[model samples]
Target chain A: MASLHSAVLDLRRLELMANGDSTIHRLDARAKVLVTLVFIICVVSYTRYELAALFPFFIFPVVMVSLTGIPPLFIIGKLALLCPFVLAMGLFNPVFDREILVQLGTLGISGGWISFASILTRSILTVGTAFILVGTTGFTAVCRALERLGMPQVFAVQLLFLYRYIFVLTEESGRASRARELRSCGKKGLGIRSFGSMTGHLLLRTWQRAERVHMAMLARGFSGEFRTHHVSRFGWAEITFITVWSGLLIFMRIFNIPHLLGALLAGSIS
Target chain B: MSHHIVQVKGLRHIYPDGTIALQEVSFLIHHGESVAIIGANGAGKSTLLQHLNGYLTPTAGDINIGDFPLTRATLPDIRRTVGMVFQDPDDQLFMPTVFDDVAFGPLNLGLSGSILEQRVEECLSRVGAAHLRDKPPYHLSGGEKKRVAIATVLAMSPDILVMDEPTSGLDPHARRQLLALLKDFSHTKIFTSHDLDMVFELCERTIILHEGLVKADGPTREIFNNADLLAECCLEKPFSMQNCAACGRPKTGL
Candidate 1:
């Protein structure tokens, strides 16, 4: 019961995230995608041993959250939940063969730690960037961007159809599950037997819905390609904003500034 | 008389599972003519409409539109010439905004820049949907969505317009508005509708389909006057409309 309530709440939060009004949401989708991509690349390129140096990279995430009005807690919480998978894959490296590579003031960190840290960092940064992009740009805008970027029209139309009908299938599945639960009197609890039947019924419903949707498309003058008229223009502000973020990322990579800054500050303080 | 824009000869369509939706259907739609296909549910009305636009291939017959054969290679041309307005606006308007939905067809035909924008604007205005251009389709009222759906095909500038259940679920005012708009179009029209009153007022010809077969096809007045034929097709003559003083005198055949 508690889990269901939480799930509903999570869905609402995601809806809010997707529909939020902020500067990030207002930017052209191309600018947002490019910035997010650059941010991911910079985060991934950092050497694993430079843990303290990586702290400055948090600025990118923080700025994104504050400007986009996305809840910091929500982004961090989602990333934290995904951490276990990265940890599991990397944990095996330490257990299989232990090889100490570096000694930092009488404490030894092995070669496995480097790889583990890389995995963890990459996972957090990639997922965080993806979440921000989708939350800010919305599905339709992302699709439009992809279309403008010269993706095949057939594939674009297919994606649009998939997005349009996914909800119908989910609603059907929800009703079927409720019916099963009501009949089962809470004992069976949607086990494999009923689940199989529910899935099959959903597939049939989807098939029927697809036919209707295709007919509808044909009626609307859809021949082979899906076309839309949502125009996007990269204003001067959007261009500069994207340029600055990309330039910073590129500069950081070229000069190794994150590492040098941390080392300089540490040497002066100690 | 204008040349026949749509010529379907012995058209038959049997579903893969062997459910025959259309059998031996024959019809001719002349240019600038408005015809209605009417019957009760499961009457193969939609199946025949799909065949007109080359959406569904016939099992054992031919459909020719303005000298263009309904073959796989000629589908694009057929679609450009014959615009189809489906029953459900939700399925037809797949784009996020009304403007996008209306502009879909024109864009597919590779119309870009100011010309595409001009056509989209004109189409929206034609359907009286210009007010809702930027609004998302999911937020539209049913009538508004239907209008946008109509605009989407209108943007294609097809020579023949085929609509499926155009007035279904519309309020009387919206239905009247749609009927008026459709009446103004010079293109050939083939529509399936349950609104008998609208059909009688707007269509010069009516085709009655029953159980995947054409039961009656002729002048609208002649078909409406045949009470026994109407009863067999599960259709009732619009007595209220017939008796309405505003609609004026009854025609000779009815």
Candidate 2:
């Protein structure tokens, strides 16, 4: 219940940050979304055993954090929370293929270890980019941009509704959980059965709330589409942003900047 | 014009499970008249209000909003005429921000540019929520959210304002502010509430629903004065009508 309450607040904090009047936040959502897509593709397309090449990709999120003025610690906390999922996914990799693939002085690393590190790094970069995108551009604007970018109308609307209702749904469930926690004297009946029934009631209540919301929408002349009045055009700045960031991402993808830098440093030292 | 009038006759609604929520309900509210529908918990007040806006189809009855009958074809026009503010502000405000939620209806009506912005501004100011326009609905206090929800309905320029529980879940100050705002609206207003004091203060007409039927319908004072009738229906007079607690004498007019 406490986590649920914090989750609601965290979502609100991120959205509140998006309302800042900073330059990066003002850019059309489409530009940020397109650039983030390019960044994700570039980061994920790296080969399975390429660990050193992934270091350069961190620059994008770092730059975004500084420019957008979002608290780096908050984004970092979110990233850390997500790290375990990525870790669990790649945990078995080192056990499967132990053939030595790289040699750094005496410590020989196997293919599985290199690939596991690569997977973890890639996930961090990709997920970090997404978080930065949302931090700069609010979720509603992102949904609108996605709709304009050829995503199906229903899917875009569903995503927006999902984001909007998440707070309400979480708050309801949180209350339900707190109620159960308080009513279960001596911690009896605090197991899965009560949780299951509480969740079922929560689902039922959520369904009824959804129906009421749909009715409210209908009463407002909602024919189908959610019309927005504040129209933001992708202008010169957007074009420049997309072009420069995308070019940098592609360049990072094509060339191993980290490897080249390491070689140059070694040569200069010798 | 008849656009502001709401008329219902022989309205009956039986849920699919065979429990009748409303039975033989009828009322005709004139333009600019404020009416309060009051009843016990299972008295079908909400079920009746839902029928007014066409959210729930009556099993057997005819509802006429303005000149047209309540049917799928005329639903849009009826909705435009009768702006419904639901009980929970959360249900009414689904948009991300207060501005967007206030502008949702007008935007769906094809408003754009400065005109739309002006409309949103006007409604927000009407509810004294202009400062909270850019904030998301989830960030607002309960009273602010309720005001924004009212602003959303007001943006549509409805001829008749229908509220389920306008003053529910509000502190005394917020409830007073809402009552003042409702008093200033020069249009037909219909609402359902358990706040008997609010019902007595705002509505000139009061309808009592008991067992999904119209138990009594008349002037607010007369309806509240009939102690025997109110007792039969398991209701009581508004607090303002009761005697002074300390002095044990009748209170002055509300």
Candidate 3:
């Protein structure tokens, strides 16, 4: 009953976030998608040795999490796990070739510092953009956006099927895991053989469930197409939101504006 | 006499494994009539219903719905009109929300904007499930889910509604509510059930299937009165039939 209650709670939370009345949530998923794309491209086009310029790109993730009410920790946590690998690849520049590139006259910095900064920035930007896109829009809206933007009908339908059945399959997997645990309590406990058997049984159950679902869909007049009730409304606000975001990203990327400002402010203060 | 909305001729179905599910099963169902296809487990009743909507291609013979042949090409159109509701509402109402599930068929049919909303709303009301519009199918009670599943097809505005054991696993009140909703529908309706009382009450015509064949097809009254045929198909007479022994004529006005 607790599990059932939690399952229901998770579903309710997802539904609320997905169909919320917030302006960001209400914007056409396509618009959000376009904004995310533009933001990522701007971030990726930055010079690999540039670090200060990439700091401004943090605005994208911040705005996404704050405005859309998407959990920031989830996106940040996911990115934290992924970005380190790409960042580590760039870390080798400082180890083998630490040549002094620019002398601040009063301060000292090496060429490896700039390259390391660039690598870190690139990884952060790419991961941040991905996080913003998925965290705010969720998978269902993202699929609908893709479909509306002329994605192949087959792919779109496949996505919908995957989304619908994933929950069912996940539930079955959980049940199988629990059953295995219960049965093994008095025995040598579950091993690879039991795990394989559980997986096999789960697959068989899912297959039957899929067939039943297909038949059910046929009964309800489904003709190899996916449909939903929520229609995303594309408006001038959505257009303007993307336009403003894109312009800001382009401006920052085209002119190293963040670094220029940082230097000017540092010079003026000193 | 009403027009026979569904006409089947020598319908046969064999699984790829060569297990025969239906053998030369033929029947006629009139429009605005509730017909119950009753049988024991594995009696080809479910297989027969599947054929009606072209869910399973007939191994041989033909099934004609209103004039259109049930075939690969015609399956979509047949599905649009036939509206098959399955035994498990969980499988039927797979959408995240009741409104989405109900609106699914209409949306697929390309009805947009206000017209789509109107159709979905009307269907939900028809099934007396308007209050559950925003609720998820998984969150709903079994009975509520069943009604919502019925609403999903009802929203399509189909001509024929074929349900596989609609009353199965429902409590008596839920069953009665479902029966009432079925009785109110003007569409050609066929539901499979072993609930003899339900069959007697709502279905004017009854067909008993046994071992992949149509064993009996006649008026519900006649079918129920024939104790020998009922026992032969492994269905017992309803306990509510008190005057059946004294009355030689088929009972009327359930």
Candidate 4:
């Protein structure tokens, strides 16, 4: 519960951070979206046991975080919450592929461990890029960007509604948590039964709210068509932003930068 | 035709679960008039209001906006003519920012470019919310959200304004400002609220709905004055109309 509470608060900060007037925020959302997509694709395409090459990809999110002036701790905290899901997927890798792949002075590391570490690294890098995308360009702007970039209008509308109502969901959940705390005789813990019923009630309430919002949209001349009126256009800056970022991302994808740099340092020392 | 003339005759609405929300509810509201529909909980105020814009099709009878009846074909046109402010502003302001929400209706009507920008700005300024344009709805106060929600509707330039409990969740000052804004709109205004005081002050006519029925419909003053009728509908007079709590006599205006 505490983790979920902090998660909501931190995620809300992403929306606030998106409103910042930094260079990253000023870039068109479509540009950021495409850059982040290219970054993710690069990160995800690495071989299962490849690890060192993924290290350079961390620069993308780091640069965005610094340029946007969004606190690194916030994004790290958000990423840490999802790390366990990646952990579950990678934990079994070490058990299945146990062949020794690398040797230190006195210790050996197996292929499974390397693959597991690689999986974890790729997941974090890809997910971190997405977080940066949303942190710099808001969810709505991203939806608009997706729509303008040839995504089906219906899907973009769905994403918009989902992003818009997440606040309402958190608020309703917060209120429900407060009410439960108030009645629990100074006990802050939520019981399993209460959690069960609370989740059911929240679902029902969210469903009803969705219906009401749909009616409100219908009342305001909505005829199943969502029109994007954001005046932000694709221009030279956006073109440059995408070209530079995608070029860098694809360059890093093709060449193992850390490996090449390490070899250069080793040869210079020789 | 100037804006909107709402005429409902024997309108009935039944939920899928066999709950008859409205039964034979009828009213005629001319353009440029302010009317209030006040009732207790479960009295069908919301169901009746939903019919005005074709949000919910009436189980029986008809609703006419200007010259056309509320039908599937006319739903779009009537929705354009009648703007609805929902009970919860959060439900209406679903856009990412106040500006987007205000522009949602006008953009749907195909008014883009500078005309759309001007429409959005005009509506936001009308609601005294131009300063809040770039802010997201989640950041707004209750009153600001309400103002922006109304601005969303006003951007459409509807002839008839229909609101469901417009002032329900507002503070006193917010309520006061909303009433002042409502008074400024020259087109037809319709509201369903438990705030009888607002009805007495803003609306000239009041309709009392009781158990899916129009218990009474007449001048606002007369309806409030009828203590017997008010009691039958399980309602009380507005605080402004009730005798002074500390004093022995009715208020000065009465």
Q: What TM-score would every model get versus the actual structure?
A: 0.76, 0.95, 0.82, 0.92
State the iRMSD of every prediction, in order shown: 3.8, 1.5, 2.0, 1.9
- Arrange candidates by TM-score, highest first: which order? 2, 4, 3, 1
TM-score of predicted structure 1: 0.76
Error of 4 at B230 (Å): 0.9
- Who wins the TM-score comparison? 2
lDDT of 1 by residue, A47-90 (tens): 75545445566667678888988877887887877887888888
Q: What's the CA RMSD for each of the models?
A: 5.9, 1.9, 5.4, 2.5
Consecutive 10-residue window with the lowest summed lDDT within model 4 chain A:
A1-10
What would the per-residue lDDT of candidate 4 be over residues A197-237, giving only the tens digit for each residue? 89999989988888888888887777766776646777898
What are the lDDT figures for the candidates, one per model?
0.78, 0.88, 0.79, 0.86
> Residue B207 in candidate 1 has what lDDT?
93
Model 2, position A246, has a per-residue lDDT of 93
TM-score of chain A of 3: 0.73
The clash count for each model shown is 1, 0, 1, 0
- Candidate 2 deviant stretches above 4 angstroms: A186-190, A265-270, B252-254
The all-Cα superposition gives candidate 2 an RMSD in Å to the true structure of 1.9
Comparison by TM-score, 1 against 3, better one? 3
Question: Each predicted complex: what DockQ?
Answer: 0.30, 0.77, 0.51, 0.64
Candidate 2 Cα lDDT to native: 0.88
